[model samples]
Target chain A: MSVQPGPATALSMSSATPAIEAVELSKRYGEVQALDGLSIAVAPGTVFGLLGPNGAGKSTAVKILTTLARPDSGSATVAGIDVLRRPDAVRRAIGVVTQRSGVDPVATGRENLQLIGRIHGMRGGEIKARTAELLDRFELTEHADRPARTYSGGMQRKLDVAMGLIHRPQVLFLDEPTTGLDPEARSQMWQEISRLTGAEGLSILLTTHYLEEADQLAAELAIVDRGRIVAAGTPEQLKAGLRGDAIVVELADEVATAKAATALRAVPGAREITADGHTARARVDAGASALPAVLAGLEQAGVLVASATVARPSLDDVYLRHAGRAFAAAHEQEVA
Target chain B: MTTMVSHSGYLTVRAVRALVRQPVFLIITLMQPIIWLLLFGQLFSKVVEIPGFESTGSYLDYLTPGVVVMTALFSSGWSGMGFILDMERGVMDRLLSSPVRRGAMISGPLAYQAVTTVIQSVVIFVVGWLAGARFPGGLVGIVVTIVAAILLASALASFSNALALLLRSQESVIGVAQLLVLPLVFLSSAVMDIRVAPEWIQTVSTYNPVDWAATASRIVLSADPDWYEVLWRLGGLLAVAVVVGWLATRAFRTYQRAA
Candidate 1:
């Protein structure tokens, strides 16, 4: 088989460059600001995560970079093609698996793959061979002739990924690939996504509302909040950068949270103490050493130490530090 | 091969397959026209004897052309329902992200409407012939009848698709489609003569693309065929098809901007 020059061929020569880049991208929808000067650079051959809670603009960034939507005042490039000026060129080098299942419910799995391949300009033989391979790889061979709506959630998600890979794109964009799946299906999808980069040399940009998804799948991740990247680093780096463990204290009395905060202030090892109605939390360099001091201080001040625990810093702490609030709290605020 | 041809071929096949897979739906939808062919042909069979009803000897001859156009309108006007389904299912987003020819994306559904109309025309004409309606123009007349059906249906198909994207809601598209088709059909000569219609409706229907189709098909099916008038009406429907289809393609821009 002769491989003629195609738009995706240019992606190989651009291996030295970042696979995806978005600079100062902004988009506004009526009263909601979907993206505000958001930007990120993804290295070639790595899984990059744009992690955020619902309504945090993660999907907005994906839409812009994938050439499905345009930015108001910013620019993006995928596989070295300007997304706005040469969107068709960018499309040739990239594949997108949107948050929702895109497979035609009326069409069978095999027909879905064949249809997408034909649109990509693949020959009939190439389409048939690739469809067979994907159906097998995704373990969809048995149900290849069945309409996609009949498949299990995991099966459907697997077919969605296979559809995106029909053209062997250089970069793949998966927008919340495992959003609605159950735990088993979610883990299965995670495993399938992790294997895409092994032999294909494909760069991936993933967006998700689940923190564990980013930690488990992305090599590098950016935590997005309110249309901005609040913090970015490898999951380990972001967690380690917090410089210690977190000490959380829950009081028996909701009104005594302020008292509990004051009681825990004397511990020299503790810092950044804050409290809500029934809980108070602090950062300490060493949990084992700091636990006794924390308890003792509360006792001396006549504050009940209802319960205390110290755990290593997590991405939750990383986001709390950068955003000045707990990650879940911020997410709840947006949802509410 | 150009992307438009090859890409549209696959997409059109998908549409047709969807129809074939749901045989009951296809049957039910096509049966509506046949019901009209029998009910209207028999109920109003004597209307040809009424003054100012310029039908051939048999009212079925006049009603046959109307039935052909009605099948096209009813089927094609809901063409956007497919797009609404695609949007709801995220299939439209998938196609937009691919390098499918932009034209192919729009033409695929339009072509499906054309193909189905041809089948429907054949069915309607076969039934019309059983009711004693003779085609004075023979093969050319039958071809012209099918062409008129396709042209009118494709025009409504484009507008329906445009409304589907612009509204992005099945309920709203259905509402607007009903609003569009009822009046256009009533205003046109598809069901009745100008003398039977109110003066205002008759005047308004002169501009109705549906009437343009009905006029051309009625002429070509008549014993005294006016070839020039047929060209004029068919040309009008074709222009409307191109314009509305273009508008539907433009609606994609609106959808993408919001997506």
Candidate 2:
């Protein structure tokens, strides 16, 4: 309940005050530790992504930071306002687009926008103008008068985000904003989100399970696992943190995967060989130079390889290196 | 305080607008009370002829106020469905995370319910008049009857909201509301006269808020309205409304913690 600034503020303020800061947040629900000592800082006018698979506490962190829920232990600040002590102030300073669509399905798109604007204490003319502008911006102007339920899923999501931005908050929280969106809609949303920090001069904290989403939109990213951040850096830095390039070989069948892993390990610069199903993956100092040797080794070992490829380190590799498991595997485990 | 009032006003409009968009629901809800007034009024017209079943006019006159009060009970009992829908659709979280006043969330819907009760009561009164029910207490009596219904609806709506916030499930809210409404309706003079009912039923109705509303409405619409009885019951309904509304607003904290 204390309102005093936490260490995250002190540390980040020394450089430039973060638009959002959370220090050692921990939350427990019965036997599940939803969030454990999670800390993050987003610089002003930049997109910071919390990247994690499902149940990695990404949404939990967003909830605590946005003042929808409180962390059992820890403090947070949004727009220099204490989240725990003065949640209303934080609420005024930030706009939150939760993972779920928050649009009132029975209300028209424009009505939803106006209602939210009024809740934020916007004036009549201001609410009207802002609502129109947002509807146009989100390509929802044509459907502004229709009940939100009539809108497509992507359109409803767009209206939800538009309602969040109606008040022009200093910081925006997009918690898995593109979740459940079609590929085209997701890319469009990414374009809009990318433009927000620059065009609107708003800092954003987005959480997503998609590695490509984090890589495409975040200025800085954190990999969350089991309620804690396992890695935090720029997306490029996270990928570069892996020792070398990744060389993956898809075996013809599960029976050849083990042999392929052993064969790939014999290559001079390759290391960390692991086999999964019908695929074998290894790291090499250089992918282009190591590719021929890898394929040759597989051929010499009589391991029938269906395909072989070498590529620069991706966010997937970074996640695997740190989380000690494949990202897709972790995601599926959480889903199941 | 001003912000809370304004926020409540805006949200009330939102709720009303949402309801208006679904005209089918509105018609369906109105149909229930009209059907009850017509069917029950005809079916029980002879009950008034029994000994000790005192009445100054036809049976329809006695049943009109009862029907109004019953409509309030039945409609307000379902008010929680709106809250449950908001919760499921994530609209509750959106409002909670905004700078909106927490109290406004409860007050807004309560206000909407009040508005609905007025409309429904007026419609029932008009339908009763068309069906041969006449009010001797006239305009003042009609206004008072509507006010009583509003008060009762507000109280029940607050209770419904509290249940919604606590249960956070549509099926359970519907189940609990259905379970409570029938006993409240039949146990009172809403349909049957308390004079002819069992002594235990009469005693139970005395403490029931539903009975207070129906009895008060019936009294005001009578040839001789009792000022003391009308005011006392209205005051009691007001107190219950305030208490239940406060509890509903406080239930937001529990929802927040769980969220």
Candidate 3:
């Protein structure tokens, strides 16, 4: 958890040439630009999170990389194969669990897996064995013959991920794998995903809106806003990129926040500041070191600081640093 | 491609197995055709029995082919319902996202529908036989008729599935298909003689591929096999199948693009 500034072996994530790569990708649906010059590189053996809100081109990027949709002007490669000219190869190399569950509800869990395996060109014996193995791995063996419609949300998500991994593709694309699940189920899925990447060494690219989901699961991350990747790095790096800890000052009024922010800017190592409504936030290299200076300065400026706290930066802070708004605010707008 | 077809064959078997799991589907599959045969057969019997019909045989014999075609039409037209079911259940998208050939994924549902269509056609044919309907062209003709019905129905189902993709709503798709199916059946030479109909009806029948299928099916059932007439009707139905199948493929592409 101790992520240092840079070149700290405290973080094991190695940024490499990316198993999945997009170059100048752009997609337009009539007047709407679904993706605008979006580019990303996913390392070969790490969990890369495409962190964004809904309709921020997360799924669009997945489709392009998974060979489901062609980008209007960009190029992409998956597992070393060109997605445009050799999409079948890309399809062969990556497994995808879309935002929507792909498990056939009427069919048994085992049947769904077997059918998917067959579609991927596996014969009966192979499909049967793999289906059984996946069902067992997902802890659905007892219910393998039961209709998927009977599964709980967590069980269905597990089945979905198992179906994707049935063919053992090198890269896995999970688009919002836990969107509608309850908190407990979402946490279980996070554990399952962590186990997969850790045990199997599979490169996973997951798209998620949950900041904690990304923080808990992703080794590397990208913050996409308005169809562009505004920032990319490991969760720790992105968090650390904002430098040290964050000082959140809740003021009595919007004017107080403005006044408090202006005074706090004079403190050394207060790298950036953001003001929203009656709250102002400042990021500094050392959060503990900068707090007292900020408090004294705000007191001198006669700004009524209702409350203030200093804590380690989060991905939210990283998002705010890159996009100049709270991550939750952007999420709210995207949802709207 | 052979391997692909073999893989699709596996999918078809799985689809059939899934249907069998419900058990009621088996009954409805047979029950639907019988209802069509008896209801439409008796309803239009008096009108169809009028003299100077397409054949010298009883109107029941003449109505047999139309009922078979109707069964096939109904079977195929409802094929898109499977797409909706799969979509809602997340099956279709799952298959689509896999390395499976797109054609194979589509053919799974289509093949299941076709196999069941053949079963329904045979059941209808047997019921007709019990009612004194005979295949004048013998066993070859009966087998050919059944095969033709299956293929024709499968092609129709492909078109239905494409429509389903475009609409993506079950009520609208099922509603539009229901509205279109019986009208096309009634407008064609299915239950009545095409020649005795009004000039407009005759002209319309000429363009109704369902009419072509019905007429071809009739040629095999009634005595005096007019091989040339049979060839013409079969050719027209096949042409319709090919065109509609292509449209279904295009529709599938659009759906994939949207996805």
Candidate 4:
């Protein structure tokens, strides 16, 4: 089921043209279909997250939107410029920080910024001032003169984002921005990204596999699975769409999983049950009231429950409800 | 049009600055040309004494132009490494996604090779002169020789860039470059006079761009410079450079499509 944006987003959606829009975009790479009739619309001045597992066509979508690759069919636009017909114009309007760090390692951070600034047609004086401002803003001023290769991974990632923002682009694309970062750096990047949308009024299209990242930063998000949007809405809406809390029971062994699944099914108000290895998960209307019945049912079935807990639905639960599988399992399957 | 030119210029500066930052890499690249000028100049010194062999004075004098052309050829053949580096580092995709003219990606490195060829040719000239080789054609001759070298290097660099864009692998680019360079150097009159070369090699050398460059440079550096021979070969090299540069620029589309 396609969930519509909440009233807040709906009001904005009706008032302003979308900052980024793609309709039924599909792309094929020989035998593999990277994108299949995927579509999305991002409101201006908001962070739109494409949340997915690895190999979910997020990068491919970014590539096409940023004009780095052509889609086999469908149409997209960034800042109202058609991506296919006027890619250069689209390029002029959007900033893209790809999954890979795009900073030139041989050049100093300052040099890298200046070069990109020049490519974006910024004048010498403008480039110098902007470069300084970005370097200072990203906390890279101390190391601005050093070759980017010399910087730490977090620092290099910051430079990449700084480079993307050199031209004051209307929209920014951050593809897996914090994928390789440590916990500290990831949070730091999150703060920086949050500030970007608020003060600058820049629309951001961020692709992330991190559920927390999407929940924390995205004003609106679309969960992509197998090259299609499985669920799309505000994080709260997607979670609320499930209509209850999630009950997770940890069993003693893999052998008990089947018994636990059958047991959990008998408990009233529990539905959408899935069991794998030593864990059995289900959705219930009210976790506090439903937990004792669930555990009692499992006990009657002679299923040994190591522990059980119930919590409000997270993006993980929303993903399970929509995608019909766990996010981690999908990621593992992709890696395998 | 102006944007294209300016982008190309900025990218060229980027390419050159990258090389300049790594002085060790720059010196190592020049080592080959310097070795050929010194060692090969001595090794082939007696070749001019052979029957039907021609020389302005010594073998080193004849070999100086050969060294300049060979340096240009060998160095330019590896220009693809830079493109491959950019591709691997994700810089190429970043630049492609920017409002960058695709032509600049090709021309920038080609221009860098041209600048490198000039520096390399001058270095070889000085080394040859220090090792007792005399160029009677003087400063004008050296300038013309450097121009020929630049043309040859541009053509090779463009071809290398095209191969890099198409192959997108270091081993493949290296394999193809090695496959092309040695034959091109030996098949041309880089170290020996064509008069002493086999009939088929002379025929092959007549069509080789390397031969055009080497022969043109040698003629200009001789006591009696052949303006006609120099101009036509330089013109031929220019045409080849333009055609190959265009192909290299088009290769960006192939890369983008595949990407």
- Supply DockQ values for each candidate: 0.75, 0.77, 0.57, 0.80
Q: DockQ for model 3?
A: 0.57
CAPRI quality level assigned to candidate 2 from its DockQ score: medium
lDDT of 2 by residue, A44-158 (tens): 8899999989998999999898898899999988888899999999989889898878898888898899988988889988889999999999999999999899998899889
DockQ of 1: 0.75
Estimated TM-score per prediction? 0.94, 0.94, 0.88, 0.95
Q: Ten-residue segment with the worst summed lDDT in candidate 3 chain A?
A: A8-17
User: For model 1, how does the per-residue alpha-carbon lDDT over A122-236 read when each residue is reduced to its tens digit?
Assistant: 9878889999999999999999999988998888888999999999999999999998899999998888888887677789999987888988999999988888898888999
Worst 10-residue lDDT window, candidate 3 chain B: B48-57
Question: Second chain only: TM-score per model?
Answer: 0.96, 0.97, 0.92, 0.96
Give the residue spans of candidate 3 off by over 4 A: A1-17, A249-271, A276-280, A284-308, B54-57, B85-90, B131-138, B257-259
TM-score (0 to 1) for chain A, all models?
A: 0.91, 0.90, 0.87, 0.94
Model 1 clashing residue pairs (backbone): none
CAPRI docking class of candidate 4: high
Better of 2 and 4 by DockQ: 4
Better of 1 and 2 by DockQ: 2
What is the lDDT of every predicted structure here?
Answer: 0.87, 0.89, 0.81, 0.90
lDDT of 3 by residue, B61-115 (tens): 7777677778887767778887887788666766665667778767777789877
Model 1 deviation from the true structure expressed as Cα RMSD, one decimal place: 3.2
